[model samples]
Target: MTHAPSPASSDRFKSFSEFYPYYIHEHSNQICRRIHIVGSALVLVILATAIITRNAWWLLAMPVVGYGFAWVGHFVFEKNRPATFKYPLWSLMGDWRMFFETVSGKRRF
Candidate 1:
């Protein structure tokens, strides 16, 4: 990812909203998007389980919730690096956004 990816160019991202298109472009595969969705769902489940069980250990699952499935997708399916390394917070937002987009039919698979 040392090479500049045309779609994720920093030139166009003056703000978070401006960066959204670039973020969307980074996720170009359906499997990658699905993996992200699963990871996010697992995150939510972990959060709920943590609150219900009152276990601090469940909070430790964030990395797995966030990175596990995404890493697998990157290595097995996309065969590319995750944008999370470049933008962690926005990468998260992008994942949820992509998930909702897929569910809402705003994104084509």
Candidate 2:
């Protein structure tokens, strides 16, 4: 089996684009992507509900609904550092892109 490449350096990322390959490298596991997909969808739903009902609670649920599943996937399946720890914004974008790639047959896993 091909092994996932270890991070070359822990040095700070200069930009989000620079961090994306490392982010994708960390998400080498199929289970991780699946969890991200579910979590992101839940986040969207929660945001939509918050918009509709104007409930502050739905906004508060973003982390629970988003990171909960994602963390589980990271800790249990991938056993790797999530890009969110460093590149929060890009990691969010990466999560959605990776989810779509997996769903649309662009990514094998």
Candidate 3:
């Protein structure tokens, strides 16, 4: 079987525009994509709850909730390391883009 190149390989994505397609490729597994969507949604809900209730501690849970689901999806379902480790900003942008895409029915859930 042919193997996909590692993200660190000569796949020089010099811009978020270029990196997004690669980000989507990393999350091709259905379950992994769903987990990411749920995590992103939960992060928004948790952040909104924190603001409405004025509970700053709830703010701390955003990353925990977000990364918890995402990491499980990556390790257990996707069987790959998350690009977040190597491309934090781009990965975060990709997460939201994917979330919106899924929600808008442009991409499947």
Q: What value does the lDDT take at residue 36 in candidate 2?
A: 85
Candidate 2 pairs with clashing backbones: none
Task: Candidate 1: list runs displaced more than 4 Å.
Answer: 1-12
lDDT of 1 by residue, 39-83 (tens): 877888899999999998999997876799988877788777887
RMSD of 1: 3.8
Give the better candidate number (2 or 3) by lDDT: 3
How many clashes does the backbone of model 1 have? Answer: 0
- Evaluate all candidate structures by whole-model CA lDDT and list the values in order: 0.76, 0.81, 0.90
lDDT string for model 2 (2-109, tens) is: 554344476666666666777788887888878888898889899999999998788989988789999999999999777788778988888888877877899875
Residues forming the 10-long window of minimal summed lDDT in candidate 3: 2-11
User: Which one wins on TM-score?
Assistant: 3
How does candidate 1 fare on TM-score?
0.78
Residue-pair clashes per candidate, as listed?
0, 0, 0
